[model samples]
Target: MVRWLLVLLMFTGMADAAPPSLYSLLSQGQYQPPMQVMLQLEQNYPGVITQFDIDVQNGELIYEFNMLDPDAKTTVGFAFKASNGSLLEQKVAKLESDDLEELAAVTLMRQKQLKFSQLITLATGELDAYLTEAQLDHDLGISYLELKLLSAAGRHKLAFDIANLRPLPLLKWD
Candidate 1:
């Protein structure tokens, strides 16, 4: 249900006018950059941000952050208004065993002291696409940065090997 709503919004007229870049929005002085919003969220949430997304609904832009709380064994999602970084809503879900494993992957990355914001910027700039979502996942000791992007052609799914900072094959959804 939520997926469908997000897909619908992607095709709506309002989403068509999304800014070309975070800097564009900054130059306009209309909305806070995603990085700043992310920093603020980190200060308040005190967890590892596992995912981030940009969404449009009701003609307003929203920045969504999904955080993993290792101590609490839960995942919390926060939605913030893009214009001013005002938090709109928050939802929490209990973590399962699989989630704990994922948490371990996140913890390993944390120990390495790697920053994902740089990768986000690189991926978006390289593809010349609007990044809609980014998530961290690991399998068989390999950590991947999964990204969803919208470009002139259509939606695209991309994966980057976090260890090497190399992008894998690109998958497009028309």
Candidate 2:
């Protein structure tokens, strides 16, 4: 009888461990589709979405997007609640003139060079590394691709220049 009770408890716990369904998440007033949020954002501030993803911040699911302004000179970040599609936060920053110039140059260069996937393959050259983030650094005059790598030693950050596909120095934070 004790063994049967233990088995029953295990099964009951497993039932509670099931992941939340989309309907449930929406009903709870906590999550919403990122695209829906983006549509609303565009209506207010027109821009092109450069990045979009769902992430958990502060124990709540949030839809995040990086938008390139219609003027093609500034980038903006927007975060919305996943459950109700409500605006959570927005960040906008102006790009430096020099950075803008560099960005234009890089854009032209990328058109004639290898794509991101090809560059990653070339950079890795047979290693357990995955691309984490890719961003254009106008200040540095280069596009940076961040890689998460696992080796005999441990996990490490590997940065590479997207323009020339050359490895860049990685900064470590303690």
Best by lDDT: 1
Name the 10 consecutive residues with the lowest summed lDDT in model 1: 19-28
TM-score of 1: 0.69
| Cand. 2 TM to true fold | 0.40
**Can you write out model 2's per-residue Cα lDDT over 1-174, one digit (the tens) per residue?**
988987997988953565653333434554454445656775677544444555655456777766565355787788787768888798987755544543553464356454334444566677643222333343355555454543434456666666666777653211
Residue 16 displacement in candidate 2 (angstroms): 14
lDDT (C-alpha, whole model) for all candidates? 0.73, 0.56
Question: In model 2, what are the clashing residue pairs, if there are any?
Answer: 30-83, 31-82, 31-83, 32-82, 32-83
Which residue pairs clash in candidate 1? none
Judge candidate 2 against the unseen true structure and give its global Cα lDDT, from 0 to 1: 0.56
In model 2, what is the error at residue 20, expressed in angstroms? 8.6
State every prediction's TM-score relative to the real structure: 0.69, 0.40
When summed lDDT is taken over every stretch of 10 residues in candidate 2, the lowest stretch is 129-138
Candidate 1 RMSD computed on C-alpha atoms after optimal superposition onto the true structure: 8.5
